[model samples]
Target: MCRRSSGYYAPTLAALALSATLGLAALSAPVAARWARTTSVAIGAGLLVLTAIPWWHGVTTKTPLREMPVHGNWALPGEYEKIGRKLGAAVEKAPVRSAGEVGALAYFCECQVVDKFSDRARLVERINDARERSWLYRLNYLMLDTDELERDRLKPDYWLDWRSGPNVGVGGWSTTGVYRGSGHFELRPDRPAHKPHPDDQGQLPSQASK
Candidate 1:
């Protein structure tokens, strides 16, 4: 796994954006204790209200793991753990290697796994993006490691295609399969999964040609 400063600072920046109202709410009087208490209580109350639905439903109705989405393209996250088992089985039973982007999907793929952040085929692209940006943004964006070693590029058996239109099955990669939004979109490979015609058994594990 590679560490990027963006991981830390992006959320910090978001938190700052969220508290922008504080800039507007600043008072002329000096009351540090009172001010802090009022803001804390407000934040707490807002949080409680946000959780009111799920908390109440869980306590009273006992909702299922697959939570119904409140709006578009939004659902419970981390279903990839369960779906990974299915993908692992599928690739083994099928004739293809693997490809994916989502960390959770990659994590549970049960393949000849490499560190996705370091060993990913796409690392060069991200590193290029980081390098292309101005130096000042480096501390808050994808960090660059000037001396980082580049891995050999290898294409996998399947190409994962993640859509963001609807939250359902991809049906298939193209023609027959309709592209829905993402739930397990990575599992929906762009091309049919297959190994080279003269399939070699001595190669890496089937699931991760990542």
Candidate 2:
């Protein structure tokens, strides 16, 4: 998705810069008005073609312009959904820092979702009364690439590889502790569970963690 922005802008910026340079070149050339006009037209045509290259590349590559599969929906294939479900169940079993920590893990798994949090005060009150579970499942909606999931199923050592880092499979992007753009993350059952800050619910990015 981020690549699309550069793909659109870089070519246009190049064209503008080239046009400005051509204008300066025309001014310095001691040609007659007719010759100058013809040169400008030729340069302008070349600039247009150059500017259109990005669009041409898109057509050739068949790149998706948008992320969403349908209007106002984020539905993914069932295989990915199953993968997410399996991951989420595993997260529930694993000792985690916070409910959202599991969600963050899932995000790295390409889930792209965070469970909605409830009122902290009320939750604390319930915890004090021992009326609710100490932790909650705050991350849901785990999604993965169906094709990749299918491919992994055929490999004998896929489960071991997944345990280390699913994103770092035998093929491309085989770097450990890195999932797409998200960094190293894993469920450590031995470590203490994470707790959310009091102001975390609505805190701004400017507010640094203690």
Candidate 3:
């Protein structure tokens, strides 16, 4: 959200600047009053249109929501576990160096979590705890950090890409990314027993050991 002062003053400043330039032009020579008025009107209209285009585009475009492929029985590699554990430990450390520094780190950590975890419940729980002690701006950071952690753990062999757009019901917009495994992991036709399926009988799919 735009802060009150900047949002209120920017347009006013722009108008003042424009008016000052036009006044100087009028003072330099005996320009017709009609000509000065026309020029000012044209400049104001141009500025309005230029500023409104991005807002209009955002309202009109229906951005697509992209989903990453869910892998079956994906193993959390030792390296992933190592990194996750280290990050988790660091996050749990007591009393950051300063409130400002804590806030910044918390913000970054939340993004990492979201990029890693996505929508996992367990990870979300852990992130929620971490966020509680963080600054208010850092709340969303927790959700994002959990997402990142999950993504990294589930697909260690792949790279993910993201695109930005509006979010549903969330007022503001956000970026969503897709991730796929590299050649190191290929799709198996025989779906793993532990895989989450729409029509699974009561059987638990075999999970890969971390």
Candidate 4:
């Protein structure tokens, strides 16, 4: 049996603790005004210190889902990369197929990333807005394609033959897929090929093809 520590709840709990402390302080203002200056200061200071304990614990134990590298070409904006890493991990664990599942996982991953910004209500609203716009669906598709391409799971020509037929696959396809435009045309052999030297073109040698 795995016992989950309350440490994971530190951030949210700390915020709530701070809010409650503030409310209490506000409510006590009238009563505190009647007390000695030293007494009021001490009580306020004590509450402040107590409120800080949870925040301290939260900061000290907070672990990022992914660590950003110090130097690399792949380095992305810190916040965006953090979101990407969390989304990537979720993608790996998912049983992928249709676009809908991908979008749902991506949204959850985005929520985790947004939680770091300390705005739960805003994050939830953002997720709902994105979902309604199908932004998550598009984002998921891009993520899926990018991951596959990086892993070499998807080939450049994967889409080239997709519309052709059921049996048509990227493999065994020609160097360039069949031309869809006007019929293929080759350079006419009759017209002398462009001469490399200017002098050669100016003075047509007898041996040069007429």
Candidate 5:
């Protein structure tokens, strides 16, 4: 929900780097148009190497790479699919609440993923409303990758623990957060789902929750 300046730095730096490289290459030759095209490719390759040099240090220092060492054909690998199936099956059979850093799992589990950017009060109200309605709910990435101060505002029935080690889950290098690694984790509901009494509560009964 919150936007930070660091997110913009990558593309900003990339554009500046490419422009400077191309500008320098253009000045060196009279054929500006031809050099611009050829030099841009070479310069871009060099920039990529220069930017990735830090990661290369990891190899020399024997630091772990931020990738799960799992083998699977899916976009996220089978481990995530398994986790999603577990969550989905549980939610389908019972009332359950879930949230995690990975958003795809909530979708796969057939539960509406709560928006992370919402105001804390509004978010909490929605979660509570869902509970009151006895609906299956999911709030992805509760205490991870978000402002830690909001942790106490709401309580989740289950937490998906995938933020740790080098991998942060299948997201790996593609994601940014306090931790990075693949998710090989488990989640269990803190309590059983209770059926909401819409008759007494004056709310519409949820067919999914039943």
Candidate 6:
């Protein structure tokens, strides 16, 4: 289950700045002392209130956050959780590959989860892509975060193929095909060879798309 924000996690800098009100008021010209103190406290209060809205909404809405922008579709997150539990159960007492969706499966499956792309390597690669792009990508990334990504040579087996495509109707997501290795085969193995719908295409650009 996804946890709703209680706003306790929000930064309290504005609340902290409230402590400076008395000092700022005393240092100001006497005529403007009250004005400065009042304005400062009001602004800080406003920001604090603004930060509380998400928490209030969380208190109101019982809906679990559900979204999948990959294919512009919606789904209950439980669907994905179900798939994870199912996969874990299938490989009972053994380690299996995951899409690095989350840590819950790792705990439930009682196995070490490592499917590449989940660690610093992929982050470094994306940062490289950012360096070659506009400021938007570079905004939150630093080139010095890591040296060039050293490829992890550990080959994966029994890979999770939970991309958007044919849905087995188990979960809301399209078929989560467990392809051998990372071959990224596009055609649904259960179906005939044909171009997948534009939305169903989730293959990596470096690998075969169809």
In order of listing, the candidates' clash counts read 3, 2, 29, 0, 13, 1
| lDDT tens digits by residue: candidate 1, 1-210 | 111122344476557645754653554246565775577677767765765765576657745534332322211233545555556666653322333333444456665333334344434544445446656435644454433534454445554444444444544221111123443344434453453221222222322374
User: Please, what's the RMSD in Å of model 3?
Assistant: 19.5
TM-score of model 6 vs. true structure:
0.46
- How good is model 2 by TM-score? 0.30
- Clashes in model 6: which pairs? 166-175
lDDT of 3 by residue, 41-79 (tens): 777787778657855664567233111123221122332
Which runs in model 1 stand beyond 4 Å of their true positions?
1-54, 68-82, 92-101, 112-121, 125-151, 162-210
lDDT of 2 by residue, 1-210 (tens): 111134445677777767766775667556555666666677778867976885677666755543221221112222234434554565443322332323223443443322223223323322333322322211211232334433433211111111223444322121121123222223333332354433335432222353
Error of 4 at 117 (Å): 22
List the candidates' TM-scores in order: 0.40, 0.30, 0.28, 0.22, 0.36, 0.46
Q: What is the clash count of model 3? A: 29
Ranking by TM-score: 6, 1, 5, 2, 3, 4
Relative to the true structure, how large is the alpha-carbon lDDT of every model?
Answer: 0.44, 0.37, 0.36, 0.34, 0.45, 0.45
lDDT of 6 by residue, 1-210 (tens): 222223433456545665566667667798887788678778778876876785566556744444321221122334445645665566554434444344544554455444444344434554566557757556655545545455542333344444444544542234232222112212121322333322133433333354
RMSD of 5: 14.8
Best by TM-score: 6
Tens-digit per-residue lDDT, 1-210, candidate 4: 011234555688667656655755566666664454555466667767876886576566755423221222111233334433444454443322211112222343442211112222323333334445676544644433333333532111111111222223322111111222112111111322432312212211221365
**Any residue pairs clashing in model 1, and if so which?**
96-194, 166-181, 172-177
